[model samples]
Target: MGNCCRSPAAVAREDVKSSFSGHDNGKRDSSVAAKKAPVTVLAGVPKENIEEKYLLDRELGRGEFGVTYLCIDRGSKELLACKSISKRKLRSAIDVEDVRREVAIMRHLPMNNSIVSLREACEDDNAVHLVMELCEGGELFDRIVARGHYTERAAAAVTRTIVEVVQLCHKHGVIHRDLKPENFLFANKKENSSLKAIDFGLSIFFKPVQMRSNVVVLWPDVAAPL
Candidate 1:
């Protein structure tokens, strides 16, 4: 099997094409390697020890900024999601303004049902890690694609929460320029399934009289004029 556990090579050669090829092999090796590989220790963070803070056992997802790991706090065994932004991107962006904005927003955003709870934010010399509650129910987009379409009642139920969240964001002078299914996550896996809005990468803040530019260009028709 290809190396499933993270290695210097996997981290260095992170790309979609190469990733799929290695995935199967990695999956085969997951169980054994998981027992052998020590969980990554988050730096400059509080709590008795970082290990007790989070136990990164699996790779949940990944993005341009970083990867999300399914972690469990040792003491409570409570599941959590930890996103680690790459060191390369930290220094890669010429402006580095977006990173600053994201961290600031996470720190300032109010805790409510409308958004994902930010448990902690930590940074070491190489990366910034944002720790949040784990949502096992999966992404809204995945559900939509799997089910094809929602019933009218289901659609309304989901849309109502989404609209409320968006309205709250706007009220706080923040604009979720990108509103899509993937960004919505299911909080409770069972009966009372709830949506927890995730990611603010494309979000921008604006005052009452201010207008923010849309960072996401869905298509040419809606693309901002250059």
Candidate 2:
């Protein structure tokens, strides 16, 4: 792919993509769209600016939709990862609506220890807030870079954990379009810590059977197109 300016007619569609995006009109899934409410959105990144319920700290990282900040809840002093997504960053009305669907998915995703938990959502005119559990162990690639290499058993363990996560997401009708070492993080700094999948900004929800076509898997001895 070559870098080029997007014409007015060819606005980027990746922002609106899903596994079943064969004929997307930039609308939310019908099931979700039906329940979407019409409401004004507010904006702000920090806790004070958006709300005083939490105290926002320095940036942890940035994603497709916004920056992630470390926050401490006032009442419980619970550490959290808040994704601050600016309304201006949303490319179109559809992008704005998708934000709602995204938040809903995060909040209601089946309880899983390997997935980051979304605690709450706070919104203002400036941005939409996605408050999530704080995972401080950092990205998987960082761990690998620090350790240099791993034993075969350890590698197999990590691979198995990752495969299970992918299976879980697919079972929920979500396709995490962007899955890389940079997106998976450990729960803590332990020799055998488990991993958690984060950053659902590019994930899309589809119907149950929509993902059955076009798929493949690779094993040590053979590459199979499923």
Candidate 3:
């Protein structure tokens, strides 16, 4: 899948900050100083800059609603990956509300070894940018294919992690009905083989009892008649 890059419209959604620290002959021109450098700032890029924020160089991944990127927060100089969800794909008005609710879910989620938790959110009229922990290890799908199918023990271990995530979601009254291999990712294999679940495209926060459609999609294993 192709990574989502910032489009002209998306870029226009933030207030980006620019700097001009370099100068020729070690001299600061008075005229230039008075001009304030006419900062080429984007309205949404600067999305509530809290300090030490990082700019994204390239996109890391893509999802149903948006794209993910490896970014650097300039304040602490820490690396983070940002998942930006476009307003368009969040079709239903109710689905938009669910995205906000999911953010709350991320905050309440425990800092465990099983899944990824959101760090912060950047908002604008066009999209919702989620800052999350950056995983250097990459996705589990790539790893599995490279090493062939996992051994019984490895599979069992991963399955346990999956269960933990599902249990957490259940506790929060949310159901990630779409559980698949591609959604699982590894943060660092050499340091620690911890899995971080990504993608909340089909996640629902309300109970199945509240929505009849939820009951139908609960069983994803069986193919539905075309």
Candidate 4:
């Protein structure tokens, strides 16, 4: 994931190649066109333009299949983040299923101060947009690098917060496969701002009877205190 705390002065755009192709004899193939149609990543979402509700501003970050932008609600003028995933990038059935599962898992989790909240989810003809609360304080990895070393109390507090987040996910039958300093962000730039887990792209719902080999782990190397 790209850093979301970068300056949003410049806007960025990504161009994707169209999957459809013209016939050899200058005629279009209707059947092939239908086969290459854009996949609907999210179900039950009305095909409404995302720009109608939120004004997408400068780009904040870019991932493999989507871009995160600084957005504002047109009605309330509240600042938020919009993560738009392009349907063209979801080439395979597994890729499409992963995107759908990500949205479902985020919505399935209960409200918590330690987890970033999803405001709304909208889908259009081209992409699926996820509107969420914006965290501007930057990633935990950067914070630790700047501070050089952490005090005993500060380290303990950080450890306790991370454990609580994991416990909460387990309670909800959701396992966050990716947990690291880069995945955690402070709510604001304040000294005592709450740290929140921001990404769930790799999370999945698990049952107690499931085999241990089904779990995926991406643990961080925490040789010393953060």
Model 4 TM-score relative to the real fold: 0.82
- What is the lDDT of every predicted structure here? 0.68, 0.71, 0.67, 0.80
Q: Where does candidate 1 clash, by residue pair? A: 4-26
Off by over 4 Å in 1: 1-52, 92-95, 212-226
| Candidate 2 residue-wise lDDT, 3-53, digit = tens | 322211122233324533555655567676553332445233233344467
Where is the poorest 10-residue window by lDDT in model 4? Answer: 7-16
User: What C-alpha lDDT does candidate 2 achieve relative to the native structure?
Assistant: 0.71
User: Rank order by lDDT, top first?
Assistant: 4, 2, 1, 3
In terms of TM-score, which candidate is stronger, 2 or 3?
2
**Shift of residue 191 alpha carbon in model 1, Å:** 5.2
Best by lDDT: 4
The TM-scores, one per candidate, come to 0.72, 0.71, 0.69, 0.82
Query: What is the C-alpha lDDT profile of model 1 across 153-214, one tens digit per residue?
Result: 99999989999998888777787666778778998666368788988766777888676454
Candidate 1 positional error at 38, Å: 24
